[model samples]
Target: MSQPNPSTTPFKAEQTFLAYNQTQAKAYVHGRPDYDRKLYDAVLQYHTSTNGQTDTVVDLGCGPGNVARALAPHFTHALGLDPSPGMVESARAQGGVSATSEPIRYELSTAEDFGCHLSPPVADHSVDLIVAANAAHWFDMDRFWATAARVLKPGGSVIVWTTGELRCHPDMPNCAAIQTALDHMQNTELMPYFNPGNILVRTRYAGLVLPWQLETPVPEFDQKTFVHRNWDVGEGFDNELPEVDLDRYETIMDTASMVTRWREAHPEKVGTEEDYVRRCRRTIERLLNEAGVEKGQEKIKGVMQGAMLILKRV
Candidate 1:
């Protein structure tokens, strides 16, 4: 008998992709998070060591071209690829360069489907390095690995990294407490959204191998995972939350408001915004209690810490 589908919520990839594009994505790029420059430097070093020179790098699952924009200076050429058209547009708008300057191109394509998208796809053995920043979760590892091998030249390598929350951000203690309380609730009451079934575990399988035999591992290839700690920085306040006019906070609130309005408009997208809102309010209340935020206090602040794994293919 054929195996039953593991997903219960009718896994329509296109819908999820579109929803991300329409709703949750901008917040992801703006609030999702950024990486430490040290990590980027280390990745560049690895690429240089492998190829003896770093020229062209490919950013797989490059949302908004954030990684590509960061690595552009280190390479002679860089390309950011993603399947979300909205994300591609955002990346282009943010990272687009003038014609006079060397440009980094952002294209829309899935990790496995790049073959069809790249008319004259990256020539075999041309790319010195391939980097997927915070995007491996959506990929099919086996096929992705095979495709990378096909495009990379001998001595080239692929690097995949996951960027999670910035638990260490000085102003994230409140956030941490909120998560703690939510965790407790999840373990006990276990709401439908917070249940184990709600968690989606995705991975990026990175390795170096030849094109002809996808299963055959390439010699001299090695892989290591790097642990990165991020500070919430309140979207860039790494050392501390910088003092600013109330408008800045209002802007953050505005983003939240927009998300709420969007959620309300499309209840089907977020799946019962009422429940999510209730959970969020409860989480905030628990966090306030944990942080000793007084009822009359005008504002509250706290800190958080989290980790990301970096894998080097060779």
Candidate 2:
């Protein structure tokens, strides 16, 4: 398939192809919620539980290589694949990695485009584990499953998870307003690419079965689904480390939209783009205040809650 121009706005097809690039990849590494230690434990346990030959692990959509960093120690080799150069860079920086190692390696490539780009990429039926952190939504699941099947060793497992709506404390008045906007965004066409649940189930319409027809189907693999909540009201309780400002936040949101940032990058529209960014910041400020976010605690809006579903390849 011909790749879309990176300079252009993102449509549905374009969105799928370029969802994880430098811009979103950068924010994704820093802005996404943390996966609980238990999540990592579950991953390790799944691999260990299956006394087969589990060695190499591939983290599809491994933004910033966060998941790879967590699993690197356990696996003989860990591969973090992504489409965004910026994200791959961030992953290399954060994942305590320099180049490819036994437990960790970062690649600037997409899961869908993995084999094509890799000169001698993973061989057929050679990989023991495959994972997609919060990024599987961007993949064509049928193609992804087929690709995974070709690479996974017999009895190898694939684990993919997506978080659910967050439940935060009511003290942060701004939380409610921000949440409302988030919910609204979800309902609108704006967030179709962001919702993992919708993306996964809907892939069936594309003639993709849920891993059932694989040569080694895992119909009854370990499944854990639940509402996960979180509360962190104290000061300095930031999610993305080092703490970025509202300006950075604005750039990320706009870049994610691609439509919104086209003007920003064009010199002729600088004035208009600046105004739009200001308005967005103001709107966020208003929503945060409505949610009980105080003047000094503008960052409190960063706190969040989420749910996770783990699908282990049996």
Candidate 3:
């Protein structure tokens, strides 16, 4: 994967997604997969074991509050911060709150400017946990780490995780062929429109530039406490999920940032944004039919390989 130019502004790379409207935000809410419950359980357990408390958690770049709401039950207060007003609105609309769950608050602020905008200014060393789910790839890591180091309490945990490369199970007939078609569409048709941040996800987050190092001393976090793990779902790995039908799969594809960019750039190719989606759906359906997979009857089991990074504050 090619690296973005060093001088490219973060906004330039993320403007499309950040400028999400109601329709786009709704698509994301419906399409994106929820994090496996076991992943949350394990992370919370680690936080408890390491810090002995789960007081507050700040979720940066929290798109639609998926991670924040899912993990809110394990903490006292869960604050989701994002620069996108549409995402914040969508998250607020979803509104998952219960007696056991931390009350979720969605704030419109960039990760780099988060602390300064807080009502009480997120006092130094006060946050017990910080997380960035699939949204971290777009962050300015150096600035984020600096903010994290300032807000996190001693032994507080920072968890960053992202999913990569959707894969279909090989057992299904013509699954490989269907996957090939989809891959061609994504890699060949939509590749140019993909933002620079996508490289981090394509590498399963191994390409992320972390401030702390495991083999060497670092200032922001404890090198000894760093942990990296990969969960391969539905591929003889942990957290296997149910098969996804064609409709669900299409919805997921619609949430791709590349698709959005493509629609904006090639309005002449497709009549409208909705027509572009219909065209892609038709393409997928035709591929599936060619593979002898019945549209509504047959479902495709797939795996989403995800990487998790956990580090404790110094």
RMSD of each: 7.0, 7.5, 3.5
Candidate 1, residues 86-113, lDDT tens digits: the string is 8787888787432235788888788776
Q: Using TM-score, rank the candidates from best to worst.
A: 3, 1, 2
TM-score, cand. 2 = 0.64
> What digit string (tens of lDDT, one per residue) describes model 2 on residues 1-314?
12222223132332432445556566554545467676677666866676545577888887777778777777777788877676777777776532245436788676866555676777887777787765665665545666776777766777666543333346545556666765564355333334333333223112223455445554444334211222223322224433345665555445343333344345464446345445555666777766566755554334433323334444
lDDT minimum window of 10 residues, candidate 2? 1-10
Residues 122-185 of candidate 3 have per-residue lDDT tens digits of 7788888888888778877767777788888888898888888778777656777767876776
Q: Give one clash count per candidate, in the order shown.
A: 15, 14, 0
Candidate 2 residues lying further than 4 Å off, grouped into runs, are 1-28, 89-103, 165-168, 174-178, 181-209, 213-281, 287-294, 299-314
TM-score of each: 0.65, 0.64, 0.87
lDDT of each: 0.53, 0.55, 0.75
